[model samples]
Target: MSTIDNTFEAQSSAGVSGPATRGSIIARLERLPANAMLVRARILIGLATFFDGFDVIAIAATLPILIGKWHLTPWDVALLIGASSVGQLIGAFLFPWYAERHGRVKAIALSSGVIGVTSIACGFAPSFAVFFALRIVQGIGLGGELPVAATYINEICRAHGRGRFVLLYEIVFPVGLLASNALGAWIVPRFGWEAMYFIGGVPLILFFVLRKLVPESPRWLAERGRMSEAADAVHAFERTAKTALPPMGDPASFESMVARHPKRKMSDLFGKAYWKRSAAVAMLWMTCGVIQYGLSTWLPTIYRTVYHAPLQLALNLAVAASVLGVLGSLLCAMLVDKVGRKPIINWSFMLCALSLALAGVFHDASVYVVAMCCAFALGWLACGFITAYVYTPELYPTSIRAFGCGVGGAWLKLAAIFAPTLVSKTMIGGNLDVAFYLLAVVPFLAALVVQFLGIETKGKVLEQLEA
Candidate 1:
């Protein structure tokens, strides 16, 4: 047996007798077939994720209007674009900590409520200052929702096809982005920018749905020594299984595994075993964040200002790019298992870099040319960006998975904050190309980080990979 399997065996042997040992819980969960319950869980969680995507880019769709309405300067625009990310950074740390302690379902529900309430408040904001403040508060919820959601999604799946399952669900996020852009084109011009915020706030209702429908992650429950609850959670899936479950191994043998490994401190993410993984994933999130936010969040405004596209046309162009982004995420969801996480991420980042470089080089070309180039770049980055969500949780053990994802999420929020400001500063001298050129460097550097530092987790069980 390999070291991980051997250690698992040893731990199992040492475990106390229990009806649902950690080993049995994992085995049962892995053995359970995909069923209606699983589908329901994905849908419930995905609804929240979809709205997270919607709210993220809704500001982009509204920005052109906000800029004109407020007579905002570039700095004000940057702050407005970046305000949510600042709050998200705080949430990235806070909610994951909450998830680790309070349980994933509660954390997700609470954050969703925060997002829903604050987003509605944003719709009623009378001035730029109020809207910005509301966004920051809403961001606290937005930031908390994703990483914890990602962690929750990652924890529940079997390792074999986990990438496909998780990424397929994650595709809803880009779809949400696409929906916001597409709807923004129709709604903002017709109903007003306030309508978008009101629509985005609709996720508030999802809070109740999630609390009522989804059970806690059994893996997390097992790790926390809540074996009976974990067993109950597992049995919920077991009841849904169309095929008979494989025999769960000796219960006592697996029960002690959690005790054997013990829960890790948050600092352990930067400690010897995990620091490199932490660094690489953090870099990946930042690279993806910078490209995604710097480009997607600003694309409409860029179209309106730099390229002189009509308002409707600007939003429409952004919707086109978002369509490409959703397609790219779907492609990643399909290919990640076969292609392996590291290769897809590494190659996609390089391709994104190439496209961005070209966009920068020919930035002075026709608007169609620049928009198409940026669209392609966003599409390619979407591939890597979606994959990062699948890969980040695999890097750490269950003990700190949510926490690790939170730290990585923090880096993403930092990038979100930095990218807009950087783009705004670069746009001051009509140096739009300079922003693209700078963004191009980030993914290229990230590609190297992945090539050198990232581990392949494709088809590997999370515990074994961490071991």
Candidate 2:
């Protein structure tokens, strides 16, 4: 197989299934083009993730109003904001467990349903405590969706432009984030804070659409020995490929195996074979977590607190910065496969550190706010953010794909948990520059780690990473 052809095909090695069902499903998914079935899967999965972007920003967007509405202290506000991150930690792990056992479809439906209902209930929260509790429930769903969706999206795509398609689906996250900021800036003044939660509730409707339109990962089923259902899922794509592509000038053939694949436990992530990849992915997640959650949760608040920008103006700047993030993601999607994964990640983390650090150095500059926006845009917002989302799931195979991704996500939520406290203590106490300077060092260190330890996933078969 060509490098691009290898991108989608599973490895030629035995797995938990030993020789049984080794690579049949992946061999099938690998030959497909940008057909209707792939397009439909992207849209369905992307929609679920798109709302996750909004859900993550729900607290960040409305905290200004919430602070006043409930007479909140900084600690109270921090607790309220971080509550969801905490919930996300649990949900991230929880649903992946469910996904590995039952199916990705069931896991997502359960998670999305949680998000929709809790979001609506959040609109009616009469007190900060009640709202905080509801957000934890909402967080569970929000947390579960992205990694699983990334795995789902990644599973369906061949490595040809895998980064681009997955990131495009993933880009909805920042767009959803940018949308939240834009809408909050527009709606909060007129419609009041409750409107943010109410508007957020709207994406819950997409959950039903997702369940109807999307199917379980065929490879997941095949790995579990459910050959009949797996064949059914794989057939949908086969039909699409037949319609979409001309007959192969040369026919390709695959070998089939007969045997029972062993069930994969979450612990397999730490087994000798997978331990290194898991560690690398976890480190990437931890570094990206600090940058991702820390920045997303605190950027607007930094503007409002240190610069004294009005709530609306601060959020507007956040939306504008996120538009830059959107543009950055578009750029990364174009170049990721061509340039490869490790290089994009290395450059992204380092540049993000430098830019964000510069934004801090001149914190009191007349252009300080724009400086921050620029730093966030070029550094992590676009390429780095896209890199982590697309790359982490690629490092693992179908057996523990969600759990591996979920572990990385848990680190992000961990960062989310501490990011607020770190900011509240410093930015609110008149030492904003110190806080940012500290944050700047993290990604730079992350860049160095990637340069040394990161594997070049480019031009390799997705399953070959483990092989």
Candidate 3:
């Protein structure tokens, strides 16, 4: 079979029962289990994303230390930060295609290894130029991690528990952020900035673990005409997961698999029924990027500038506040399916707006008051988008899901590029109130956009969603 033909037909009999081209995929989803293999997959991806979050935040956390150690100027610091962001931009735009063309499991493994090695190298860099270059490389690795993880989970996770499962992955980000901040606090004081890099490199060790354990995504395999191998993977999943998975049919010829699944191109995302949904996901993710990244990158800076706290004190506060963010994400995972996407998002944002507004009031308030407001805002901000990470894949049909998710989420990395720059420049320029006030607008806008364009997928099947 031609590679293109193989691509569409590559599902393991165990992974999915239908041809990729027709019928609802969700009906097939019911057969998969909430088994150990499924939890392992989610944990593996969550841990990887946790590291991605850790690496990104670790760089920021160590900046104060880097400034003192390296004697960097303001411009140098900006360049250092910008380098990683630029690399993330390139990776987010291009990595999905690589995964689609090469393989999802391979792409995920490579991205993880790259982040690990680059993180280690970042610690030992002899100069700012080299350090910035390594940061860019690490960014590329981190950037690829999320989309690949999302695609992996989307293919393997059963329809019933998929929403909570994916949100669990999202919850890992704040968990990672808290880890990074905790590391920064412990090591930056005792061991200095390089310690963060050393710790960040640990996930590289998981590369071998992943290589041995992480199977090729069965859905991708079935779509690609490698049915037998895919089927083997499914059996392995059932064994390890302890789930009563569906049995695979007789191994199909590659030609027959293609005749079943059919390849979907990126351009399919623009089709009549899908474009609006795509646009909604794009906006929602972008808004998520603006608020989440904006606040995270700037929290320490805010504490330092407004509260006149020491850098150590500010980072400590940011670390504590990050824990609140994690708690909020966990809450989202708990409530999202029950509350429904729109309501959780709407309520999260309304609370976020109020929190941000409260934070704005504390621009000059007492230290305890300021900390309380920031903590509340952080909770709302984290939960608001924990829901998005779960909702995006549900928005598209299986044939085009990866594409829909990749494209819809592109705006997030795009927002990351500009939000940090804008927030840092404006807030540090003594317009801190303006920064918080502007952030207050995002949740409202996110709520409005979701209300207008969002569909409730809470307990509905994915097949019905596609129709």
Candidate 4:
């Protein structure tokens, strides 16, 4: 009899029978050679991630134009920028629970639909109250998509080169950010701020495409004891392999490893085995959130209002910073598996702090100097930001992986909800330096926390990591 047949017999005799045992499912997946299905899955999921990125900065790009057209006050600008984040915060808490109960793909599709429909409504909003309400509703979709998507992508990939594979897919997000800025710079000026929201709504089509093309995470299925579905999902990927597959590992051993760990509950996130990890990731994500949204949402407006730069020049500079962000994310993707997650996160946060401090110190200098420093700060933070997606899911077991990611993302949304207002208040006298200085502190503290508390998850399988 074949090894897989023996695995099934063993599982059946052990009173754990299913169409396929979880051990066989995992062993087959781990041995799957890269193929068209994996690429296709990545691309389809990357599109959802891309739109999340695009919509995130869509407000940043359009804010400068809206500020003038609506004659918005600084508080109004803060509220508008924060509206989606508020919705995202709510989505962050809600969807992960949905994903944990229903499935990742379903949660993602529903959220994408929410974002697409509301984003279209945002374009047609007739008043500030209407737009603000639309943005918050759109934010719910935006908030739900990313963490679930990250969890899905992480579950599908094998441990070997997983970091590079997932991070490469994640690069699309930064590219989306870049695209929104580049397009907004061109489109909003020619068409109107409404065009940005119209364009943002185009991802509605992706909702259907996702349902058709992408399969659910087999790891998630196996964890949920849906072995029949898990087996089918594994075979779908195996069919795409061009080369001979590697020998499957011992399924009995894999099963034993999994059985050794007690089933994790959501409350365990703050329990002994996980609380440190939860704390570290929370701080990491929130700090990244405060810095990322604080800058991306405000840079263009600061350029326009404080520096008196032309609207195009301000948007163009934001575009330049996004380009640097993409480069930094790419660089991290290439190196994450090699150097490992902890060191990369630590160094990136520290360097980001240095850059932000420099920007704050030189805030009194020429606009170009401050811009350059802030751009570099964002570049460094992008490295840590992208790494968080890779690292957060790794820290949790399969049963709670999506939920863990959601909670970490919740911290991000929580920070994002308050960051714009904090930035606005600090820049009261056009003192951009104060915001930068304050932003620098959180990341530095986070780096220290990571150094002491963060778990290293390089080149390790998800199940094994949980063990």
Question: RMSD, each candidate, Å?
Answer: 5.3, 6.0, 4.8, 3.6
Per-residue CA lDDT of model 4 for 262-356, tens digit only, reads: 99999999899999999999999999889988777899988888888899999999998999999999999999999999998999999999999
User: Which sections of candidate 2 miss by over 4 Å?
Assistant: 1-22, 242-264, 367-379
Candidate 1: the clashing residue pairs are 12-253
TM-score of each: 0.94, 0.89, 0.87, 0.95
Q: Relative to the true structure, how large is the alpha-carbon lDDT of every model? A: 0.87, 0.73, 0.72, 0.87
Clashes (N, CA, C under 3 Å) per candidate: 1, 2, 15, 0
What are the runs in model 1 whose C-alpha is more than 4 Å off? 1-18, 249-262
Per residue, candidate 2 scores C-alpha lDDT tens digits across 1-467 of 55323322322211112222435566656666657777788776777777788878867788887877889887887787789989999988998878878888778777877888898899899998899899888999988988888877777776567788888888888888778878888888898888888877865776677667776888788778775566557656656653543232111232222122334467887886667667666667776666666666666676777677877777877777777778778888888889988888778777777777777777778545544644463446468767788888877767888888888888778877887787678756887777778777877887777677567787554665552
Q: Rank the candidates by lDDT, best first.
A: 4, 1, 2, 3
TM-score of 4: 0.95
Model 4 lDDT at residue 258: 89
Residue 27, model 1, lDDT: 72
Residue-level lDDT tens digits of model 1 in 334-384: 999999999999999999999999999999998889999999999999999
Model 3, CA-based lDDT: 0.72
Q: Can you write out model 3's per-residue Cα lDDT over 1-467, one digit (the tens) per residue? A: 76434433444334554444222222233456657766777677777888988998886688877777789755566567667777877677567767776677777788889899999999899888889889888888877777777877867776566778788777888889889988787788888788899889977876778857777776666566565555555555655646455653233332343344335567767766667677678778887777766777667656765678888888898888888989999988988777888788788888988888887777677766777787888788788777877788777655566656667557777777677766777655877777788888877787788888778888754544663
lDDT of 1 at 179: 98
